[model samples]
Target: MRATYPRQDPPRGGVRSWWGKAWQRAVEEAAYSEAELKGGRTAARRGEVGGISVDAGALLAAVREGDDAWTVQVDVPVLDASGRRSLVEVVAAESGRVAALLAGELPHDLVEHAEELGVELLPYGGELAATCTCPHYLAPCPHAIAVLVQTGWLVDVDPLVLFAVRGLDREALLSALHARTADLEEPPARVADLVDDLEIAADAVLRARHLLELLESDAEVPDSLL
Candidate 1:
């Protein structure tokens, strides 16, 4: 069976929430996948390096907390032209907890590179505000925009991914999933891929029969049908 789409939260205060806007954009631009988002090209200068890596499952787990705010450390790998790797650490903060992190309440180093990557720990109540360190004055330079687009897709699959960048763990996420569906006896089975050619053939036959019926009713063709 196909997975059912989740119900979206109602718009509030005559404005759509950042999360809501992200979701709408994602459905509208459903061209890229999670892997493509994470592994795509970067805008690092010839000798410069920076990259973003996120665990979608873990991030979604953190977002599910709603009232509870948490932080996580993400190691983004930046590479040079020669494939040399350098790590940049980011401290991701969640809604309601952004103030704390912003005020230096969190116990992690918000690396300079992360701040440059236009990383923002958006709160649940506000829009996703970001500032990039790239030379471009845009809130999200092309690189940051690419990352944000990918992040949106991740949230569609698992809302907690919104927090995963902030440092949520996998085991903790699984526990949360268990709690959400604790009463279910077993997990649902996965849907198999459809045979495209077979579906096309069936549709073609159906259309042909309908057309033949219409022609015969109008006395435009013989009753015999193929």
Candidate 2:
């Protein structure tokens, strides 16, 4: 399915949360001056970023600057195949988590579990890098920074965007989970076996009730039966 990035006000701690702060820090480190960083933040808040496409270890967005359009690209490396498999294993280990993610919810616990599995879903410290077609010479000029900020907002809504930036889209991840769990599932029980098991249980229950009745009546039980 084509991914969606619904417009939204940045979440609480928009620049303070792990993902948000990390992106901000990376952008700050990359920027040449505070003015540029401040301008980028303003653009992001003003919703100048749109047509956001997140995949292939990059985020592509367009910015409208007074009738002129600038293309912005944020490049970050995604996990290798082995790392992706490790994360998939973590998700598959908990079917409920997989179900939640597939249903379009990003659970905090799932992110925690990914961390424990050695998969860092969000970029950290100096990991973010960017380029934009604007006239500014900085690596992540205001346009690029705006795109990055908007991407962080998208990440808040769906952690899978983080994965998508890491080169593993939702469909691919779910397919991996299905493949991993397929062999782990037990075959369905046969009808005959289920019926026989139920019948045996019923007989045992009847015998127990009969013995209880006999004890209550103070009846003498046969020695052979005992």
Candidate 3:
């Protein structure tokens, strides 16, 4: 799903919000000067970024500065199976965390545990590969920086954006959660108990075979029993 930049003020969450903090970290990690980063933030806040398109491992945007237009591409790292599993396990471990994430809020503790497990739910500069058509030597021109910042805004409105950039789309994440839920709802069969049942079934089969042999010698088999 595509998340547009919000025209209104963000949900009063700011840097305290999970995505905001993530975005801040990414911007801070950039080699850009403070003035340049501030300009990019201004552009993002002013809604100068548009035509946003998000797919697995990338976010595309059209950034407008005055009459000049620039194309920005932000490469998000997709999580590997182990990383995805770690995230699911962390989130599914707590019902409240699941609920909060479903409501478009990133639970702080959940993110912390995920980070501990080596799963990055947020965009670190190392994971945020960026490029722009603008002539600036910086990897992220101001326009691209704007889009990256707006990405955080998108994450705020939709926590799934975090997964989208991290490599799991919203559907895949939800599907994983469903699988986790199904696993939780369904009790696992005990190997020892199943083996015992199989043994009992085998014994019953033997007893039936012996009885059939005896019946065949003593009397006609009953069709009703068959």
Candidate 4:
């Protein structure tokens, strides 16, 4: 399912977050050409890339060069189900991670915890699948690279952009965490609940006995009864 589009404002801070820097470095190292990387970063800085449509495993944007425009998309592999579950569990394990996420920040420790669980929350250089609609010979044309660079800005403002690319949206992530909170806040099992559970077990046992009685013959006792 497509996640809600993340709203991004330009970073008010003078420098990108450490996580954002990591993302940029990963992208830069993966790119085959430094000229393409420079061109892309330049376009992003000049606001040449329009609004990006962020999705699970995909990022879509239009990069404009003067009168020319081309559609660019970067495909990121979605995290597998096991990794996503581990991510949720790790985030829920720490109260600080939960609080940081709720406060619109991605905690440094959260990423580290994810790494411990064998989940790479950020895409490395080899993982980027960039393509462009423009007829360019470059494997990752300047337009596509521009979109990728523009995405780094979004990461700077809100690091959850990484999650969206990995098949989970920010709202869904928060909702999952909220469910964990609810579970923690849930009242402990009461005496009455335990009694009810015992009664259910008793009923199941009686039904099993009745079924065995019907199936057994007069000459033969079931091994369970013996």
Candidate 5:
């Protein structure tokens, strides 16, 4: 089913409201003008964030598949650092997937985990697709909305912090893989060269001994005593 929700406007008291503070910080970090944040909010109110809108039904389907439970899709507006706007389609998964997708693209590891859990991410194309099995269909659907709103508050604290919830955890995963791959490779070729050189020296010693014995026999003047 298709539904629309009004984009939330930034609170008026500048940075007083959580979203306002987030917008202010994002603007500062992005080096974008205050005018841009205002413009972005305007665009978001029109239901465009990162150039896509979530399809409620499709999102619900993906979330249900992932969570192994039933859920309804809800619509919400989101704005990115660029001030571009789009509708975020969210569903409640077991937990946190919605947060990850909404904050940014899903990390490869998170995607892999979702797949392992038989959870499918709906087609977003810059929109968010979230899943929750609860039956609410409102724009935020209460539970899902709670997550989204909290996510916004979190962004105010540190925009990138959303990545942890989304399942990226890249630093730990990469370090482990690097250590494993290093262990699998051979030590080095220097050990092999040392072994070869030892064999050659042993052979040379044997050959020199044979040559000396032959020379002694050829010069056997001591036999005249017999």
Candidate 6:
């Protein structure tokens, strides 16, 4: 799935959003050299990057450096079915986490927890495959890097964009999330606080066996389990 974000007026600061900084860090760390990223940062700060489009496994943008205009694309591997479930499980672990993501804020540590569960919620910049219409031959030319910088802005506005980049669109995430947490919605309110040891043991065994696990949740299963 693809998600398009509108361009915003440039922010005075480099990146102030919670996930935006991490996005910037990933892009900067992936650079071949500081000098390679320097020009891109300058271009981005000057509002040369505009119109970001994100699809499963790819990011595209329009960048202008001086009189030249170029189209830039950066591709990253998207999550398969198992990976998506892993991500959903991680997010569904806490209602507050889902609330935070839907509210457009992603704490960096949330992704760290995801990493521990064998899910890569964010792409490693060094591993990105970038292409640009510019003359530069490097994978992430200045134009491409500039586009990534602008993409950080989009991530700030919608944390779900990260999911989209990893191949889960908004609706898919909601459906999967509901599926993962649906099981927890069962039980009467009076006894809902009790932990389900049997369910926990089963999930642990399934996880140990490399079986597909439902999304992690605490409540009873609701209708429509996937």
lDDT scores of the candidates, listed in order: 0.33, 0.69, 0.70, 0.72, 0.34, 0.72
Candidate 5 vs candidate 6: which has greater TM-score?
6
lDDT of 1 by residue, 94-117 (tens): 222223222213322332333355
Candidates, ranked, lDDT: 6, 4, 3, 2, 5, 1
Local error of candidate 2 at residue 201 (angstroms):
37
What is the C-alpha local distance difference test score of candidate 5?
A: 0.34
**Over the stretch 129-226, how does candidate 6's per-residue lDDT look in tens digits?**
78999888666888888788778777766778888988997778766755554476564332222123323543454354222223332334434442
Report the Cα lDDT for residue 214, model 1.
65
Off by more than 4 A, model 4 = 1-14, 181-185, 188-226
Provide TM-scores for the models. Answer: 0.26, 0.69, 0.72, 0.75, 0.24, 0.75
Quantify how close model 6 is to the true structure by its C-alpha RMSD in Å: 13.1
| TM-score of decoy 1 | 0.26
Which residue pairs does candidate 4 place in steric collision? none
Error of 3 at 28 (Å): 1.9
Model 2: per-residue lDDT, tens digit, 19-121?
5455556667766677777888898888777778877677778887879989888888888888898888776565466545543455667678888878887
User: Would you list the clashing residue pairs of candidate 3?
Assistant: 78-167
* Deviating ranges (above 4 Å) for candidate 5: 1-126, 165-167, 173-226
After superposition on all CA atoms, how large is the RMSD of candidate 1? 20.6
User: Which wins on lDDT, candidate 3 or candidate 5?
Assistant: 3
